[model samples]
Every structure is written in C-alpha cells, then in structure tokens.
Target: MNAPDDTLEFTGGLVARLPEPADFGIALAEGFARRIGDLSRRAGAPAAAARWAARAAFAA
Candidate 1:
C-alpha cells in the first residue's frame, strides 16, 4: 500500500507525514492478525480466535 501524502502540522509549524517504514510495518501487522485469526478458527478454536490473533499480532 502507498503511504498517505497528508502531513500533520505541529504547533511550531513542523510538518510530519507517515514514514514508509512505519506504513509497511502496519501493513504487515494487519496481515498477521488476519492470518492468525483464520488459523485459529480453522483449528476449531473459534472462541479463542480473537485472543490468539491479538497475541500473534503483538508478538510479531
């Protein structure tokens, strides 16, 4: 995914935008979450899917 071009203006007039590295990290985390959730459900642990998905995402 492409990083947004929008910038945040600070009190001192400093402009900040989402860095490419951070954007990629966020995308990866999202992918991990989805995959973990799917795997958990497929293993017949739907009840714990959300919890495990969260753990996997953060542990990455």
Candidate 2:
C-alpha cells in the first residue's frame, strides 16, 4: 500500500502496509493499533493481528 508522502515509511518490516499514525488523526498508539488490527484481520496476518488484538482490545 502506498502511503502519503508526508508519512514515514515502514522500513523496519515489523508490520507492512500499515497506515501511518497521523493518517488516523488520533492518538499515536491507538491509531496505529486500530489500523493494524483492521488490516491484519483482512490480510490474515496472525502475528500482527495478535499484537493489534492485545494492544487495542477495546477497539475489537
């Protein structure tokens, strides 16, 4: 997924194709977890999904 030019790229390879925290226009951690949770659920990425689930349990 191509991110906006203003956002930092995920070169670390922890979770790929995640939207930048700023994209959600909310708290950094919460936004990161929310986007990852949704993406992982759709992409069937179990590791990322698990992290998202644990970090953002309220969102799920």
On lDDT, the leading prediction is 1
Q: Pairing residues by index, what is the TM-score of model 1? A: 0.50
User: Where's the lowest-lDDT run of ten residues in candidate 1?
Assistant: 7-16
Per-model RMSD to reference: 9.2, 10.7
- Pairs with steric clashes in candidate 2: none
lDDT of 1: 0.50
Structural similarity to truth (TM-score) of each candidate: 0.50, 0.33
For 1-60, candidate 2 gives per-residue lDDT tens digits of: 333343322223222345665334333434465566667677776875556463664244
Tell me the number of clashing residue pairs for each predicted model: 0, 0
Residue-wise C-alpha lDDT for candidate 1, range 1-60, written one tens digit per residue? 553342111111112234656656654555565566667777778656665664566457
Evaluate model 2: give its TM-score.
0.33
